[model samples]
Target: MTATSRSLSFALKSATVRSSSGHFLRELLANEHLPQDELQARQDHAARAIAEQAMQESPFYRRLYGERGIDPRILDDPRRWAELPILDRATVKAHSGEFATPEAVGRGVRTALTGGSTGEPLRTLHDARVPSLALAWRMYSWWGIQPYDDLARIGRWSFGRMDAVKNTIAWWPTRQLSLDAAVISEETMTEFHRAVTRVRPRLLEGYVGALLELADFLERRGLRIPGPTAVATTAAPLTAPVRARLEDAFEAPVHDEYRGSEFGWMAGECDRQDGLHIFSDVRRIEVVDADGRPAPPGEEGDLVITDLRNRVFPMLRYRNGDRGILRERSCPCGRSLPLMEPPQGRTIDVLHLPSGASLAHRLTALFSAHPESVRLFQIHQQADASLTIRVVPGPGERSRRHVEDAVEDLRTRIRHEVPVRIEYVESLPYTGGKTKYILSDLPAVVPQAPTPPPDTPSVRA
Candidate 1:
């Protein structure tokens, strides 16, 4: 096609997509208040459809399920997602090619690479609209923000020239002013602050670390941005102290958003902000125990999820390596979708002691409690199993005292003496443009094994 003709064709196609997406957005808004039974029915229908598609079209699921004696016809029977084996990132990485299917929702599927936040990078596949829909439902539908509202974002922009332009084009329509999270300095932040204040967007959104850093910088300089209706933080754990500072500094209500790079947006906060409402319509989510069976409701465990909409590369039971709890009740926002405790941290962050293991947030509880004294901290479990905490002092003068107190408090709670060391620093050094709140110097990652189904069939290549 000629260049001008191609441009004209693209513009026409874009208009059609926008019109249909507007209708889909309205349909999603309508689905928000659906009764529990109706929501379950929708989820069931989607799950059955996705599951059948995977078993039939995706080579990975067909072989895996067949070898485990899971007949494709079994999807016709009423079943929970837990009945199928738990799928982890490690397994997906090993058999990635087997996962792909020709099916898709939008134009077609494309490759997606994760940030390797858990120290292992992942490559997955997704269609275009699934991600757009995820973000829209999370922010626009759930958070009660409008799609066309002016938004200011602080996030990592790609270093590549071409990738950077792609990012710009993707976000261009949102009327968002974005600042690169990688380049945060007094000069850059000042420029960003000036720009944001000038725009006065309705909502401010960014990674947890970037937002906190901006809040700290603004607080230090005594410069405040007067008017953001709301703040949304994601990409890392948003502790209470972090949320408070963002709200205080921005002068707005702060909400936490939960998502995975491998999977699209899974859950996020609504206007009520009590808990994250899992996007159950597109995601079949469960909190699974270490053995991969569903954890009892209200108990925290690893999250095993399946994307019901992404037939392009169906993730049947993907353990994206994050851990949290599923609330027994629905959100107070009147959505029938199930609620979940917001992600505390990735499973890799969970500290393994000789006696027992502690969740990442619990281990950081003391430091999080002393936010005035400790600006940032990382809990590292050495190969020898000794624990070392590296802390960056806050603007407050009581860093040593608060660190001592945290050590003492942790000792009491764990009730066991483990070799523990403290290292103080001016800042948490960045690795790949982000800071790690928890690290493991251990040799390797332990694989999680799921319970096997009965009546197995033979394996095939």
Candidate 2:
């Protein structure tokens, strides 16, 4: 074999060694070849097992099932699984402790605190060497990344002992490098760019917004770092414009990953770049309509998920708070795993009306007509039921009329006099160095609000 071929062969072997028991890796390889009906049967069996265990072990779930009069066996029936109550982030946060079973805790599962884009901290527990990590490794493998290959990640640093230890160990075998996304300036970007140059990672992963900002800075400074084989973005939506820009700046293909802190690596883009393939062996994903019915293929709905492997804290039919469409057909890549549209954003960001109604993905529609005038926008809802429309206007008075027109259009679409006010600025302020599209300063928002939207919306030219 050629020297390059020999190096790849060695790396694959190292990856196999690093995947703990390699149980998940082996299962993932097998499941990919399984027919759709067989795959669904496996997921159904796993789901029923998780539900039964949750009712038996978890205090929170046991009490919830008892109160709702839901038999744990309902999950055993494919049709009845939809009848079980849905759990959201607030419910999980409130009863997080009860979600952890004595057996799981005694067996020493790892707990992770994920604040996400909402800035609300959520703590969850899983096995120390969770199957989700193996799923992630498999996804990376699709992008030609082995577990021991170099990966440069840009995100906030975790100071926990476990995080530190994992980082230290991952670096040795994989050369994992991390750059802080929380701090960004000319000096910091220059340093981060330099680090990427030295590491020369095979894969780059992190928040799309942060990378886009860094890419912009690098392009302006005429500093061209060699592109990695692939760039994967999580924690935020990988909008088309941002994806194109990142690909241009880094000279690499950008792929989107759909996952959350509650569950790691639910689905990911394949080499086809068509839609994300569900990690069906580990998690069962569903797109449900308002009445909690399964949405037809190619129709958008709320994303509900069930964790098949997280026995400690069963996340069955858990509302992911994101909206996406379920694709009707199989992927051209020939992977038996199902497909779904990349999430638009969180469900909380959907404008809620008191008339037993809510609107999804409508926030961007208000400014669509005023593309040239608006540079960026943020919608902030106040406690007193007033709306603050924050806008970063583009240069020149020619665009001012369009901005005003857009605000008027928003008021009309809202169909309510909620006291809309427009605030113009050079740029919208970011919390923890990240910009949010929709923010609520209302005191009763968190733990009460249903759908909180993500960071600031990008301007259309």
Candidate 3:
């Protein structure tokens, strides 16, 4: 066989083996018939297995455990697992090499970059086993999507060339229905609608902004794509207003997923939609107070995650830069995983007004107001309350009139009279470190421009 064919075969076999093993583990943990204590026992066993793997293979963890003077065997207790120090994007980026397993890095495994929402991009590496476990866990718990299911697909709306190679390859195994969200033209939107109608995949997934754009198009034109079994939104936070609009248009139960490039799947919305279910099996999640100690349940703190699945590249106690509260009450859905309140906007998202009051969630409504002409845009708030809006027009003029109209719409929605300067840049700047689209920026709070992550590089408009 050709080298390409051999590589494909090896990847498929590895995915299959990992999937099988992961399914067996998931089934053991997700046994609804078992008592609560029994399920907890199984969960503890799984956590220990993952912890042991990390302790053995990961260089970062080996150093960490050595420094802490704690044996990996002592991680048998779930409570002790929480005591491990939390990590953040800065730490991961600063010490990327130390985190990876020597063998995996030497063999040239797949590397991915995260477009951090806060403009801090993180470069991450993963073996096929990492994504394999993620896919298996997702299938077993969330949608039960099998490898053979044609309907198991991914919908991506991104604007980076680095992703093109990986995305193209991934599409071969699982059908990928792609929509070029970078430039949302009339033709692109029409093509997107057509593709969605044709695919009719069981699961629909994409960024919150892109999905909402499609939903708005469908709603405005009185058009509807064939309904999928489930609609999953990620990459961007899903506000209640956007979620309501997407659910109404798609006619499917909407679920939110919280993940990072450094770490695979950290938390996701359960069927109940009450709160995000933390995947304690593959990772340890901590809600820490300002003092860096573990916050009590029902208290708000920064989210730090330690990814146990990625031994090749460990993400120990990685801070996600998201603030959320951990709810103490058990979810009605009956999953043993802990619940976290839907994360509010990121720290960089806060708009500090001249009056001293901070504004969040206001910009979402402003952007969503003009769905047809304006496809994607970013807002930067100056210290004096003057705002700079970078916009990508749908199919219309980027003239002063268009700017004024958008600004008027924003004023009406926000009920604040702030001077609006519209800059029709080619594209909004991405945080240099990551590929995520930043919706709002306060110049005062964030003095320096954020850099996009290396993998998912950004362009300046």
Candidate 4:
């Protein structure tokens, strides 16, 4: 091999070995076979260590806790965690640099940007080791993807020119791995089919919408690529219909990964598909009701996450715009991580009715009820119970009554007495960055009521 080729080969081999070893350790740590009490004890220890580190390192936490009149010493008791105020996307954006530890940032850390579904893009920095650990955590929990076997990643890299080098370097630890961004396009589905057949990847990972489109294309062309051992879908919402199609097309179990740019990999789906298992070791997650109190087990609430591992830019009690119910039940697979059944779509999909009560998670159900007629759709609710339903009909007779019935069903579910307007168009618009199928156009409006303040603790940095 040439000098460059030799270097690439060596890098690939080294990455594979490192990944395999990391995964082995993570699996041991996360194994459900361990006694529940033992796991809880371990988690408690890790949480304390992380909280202490944040109090010492992060300026944002130092100020936040000081203002809230909290003592960092109280971190020893996990029960006092709720005293820390929750952080949201808005707060993070407003105070990005303050969250960073000066020492960590000085060490040549990397940065990641989030094009959140709410139309706000925020950038945050992390230590260099974070991505590798994030990947290891994902491999151990989701697909069992080891270091060197060939694999394919199908999403667009947010970075432009850097992507070519990043993609090349990402495959260095594993031999025979190929990264393909072309899979995002419907027209490139044929190309993807040919490439996958050639590479015969061990794992397939990418946006759920792109994968679903490719699957539809394959189904139409009567073609089947070599089946991968595991498939991981992320980046976009995975509706029931889309997920079902992916499983059928790949002829393999599909794993859904719940992650954000801020928090690398928060939760993962196992073979059982009961619910996504939250990564309790890496991050602390809380499901809080509308009143900001802890939601009971199996009750839907906002997903609040604290990235204990990300001390360079701490994400304490960050409000992820997704909602889900925390299930107290243990998984049959024997993993000890907490379980969460994420609400199907983004928070935007939930409409607010005229009666001041917000609608629930029945939008997906409404669409699934008439799957054959609707191809793609998006719904947005305005302030006065006025709603807009945008639909992109598939190739068939456009049934006005069926479309009207679907809207009526959604209206009935959302509000007993409210009006809705349905608009059918040739194609729905894409968000300038990613092709997110669901969106909420509601303006960010914080309530005027002086709510119970977040738990405040003082940190000395």
Query: Which of the numbered candidates is closest to the native, going by highest TM-score?
Result: 2
For every model shown, what is its TM-score relative to the native structure? 0.70, 0.71, 0.64, 0.67
Q: Is candidate 3 or candidate 4 better by lDDT?
A: 4
Model 4 spans > 4 angstroms off: 1-33, 106-108, 131-144, 157-187, 347-461
Model 1's TM-score against the true structure: 0.70
lDDT for 237 in candidate 2 is 73
lDDT of 4 by residue, 262-376 (tens): 7777777876766888777666778887767888998878878877666667677787766778888888777777788854445323344445344432343344433446555
| lDDT for position 87 in model 3 | 70
- lDDT of candidate 3? 0.60
What 10-residue stretch in candidate 1 is worst by lDDT? Answer: 444-453
Q: Which 10 consecutive residues of model 2 have the lowest summed lDDT?
A: 443-452
User: Where does candidate 1 stray beyond 4 Å?
Assistant: 1-17, 104-107, 129-131, 157-174, 347-461
Query: Candidate 4: lDDT over CA atoms?
Result: 0.62
lDDT of model 3, residue 98: 76
What TM-score does model 3 achieve against the real structure? 0.64
lDDT of 1 at 40: 82
Model 2 agreement with the true structure over 355-447: per-residue lDDT tens digits: 323322335334544343555677777776577888777566866777788678767755664778988877767653345666665443222
Residue 431 lDDT, candidate 4, scale 0-100: 49
Candidate 3 ranges beyond 4 A from true positions = 1-59, 62-78, 105-108, 131-174, 346-461
Q: Write down the RMSD of all candidates, one decimal each.
A: 16.3, 14.4, 14.0, 15.9
lDDT of 3 by residue, 51-124 (tens): 66666777777787789886767766667766666776656656667777765755447776543554333567
What would the C-alpha RMSD of candidate 2 be, to one decimal place?
14.4
A best-first ranking of the candidates according to their lDDT comes to: 2, 1, 4, 3
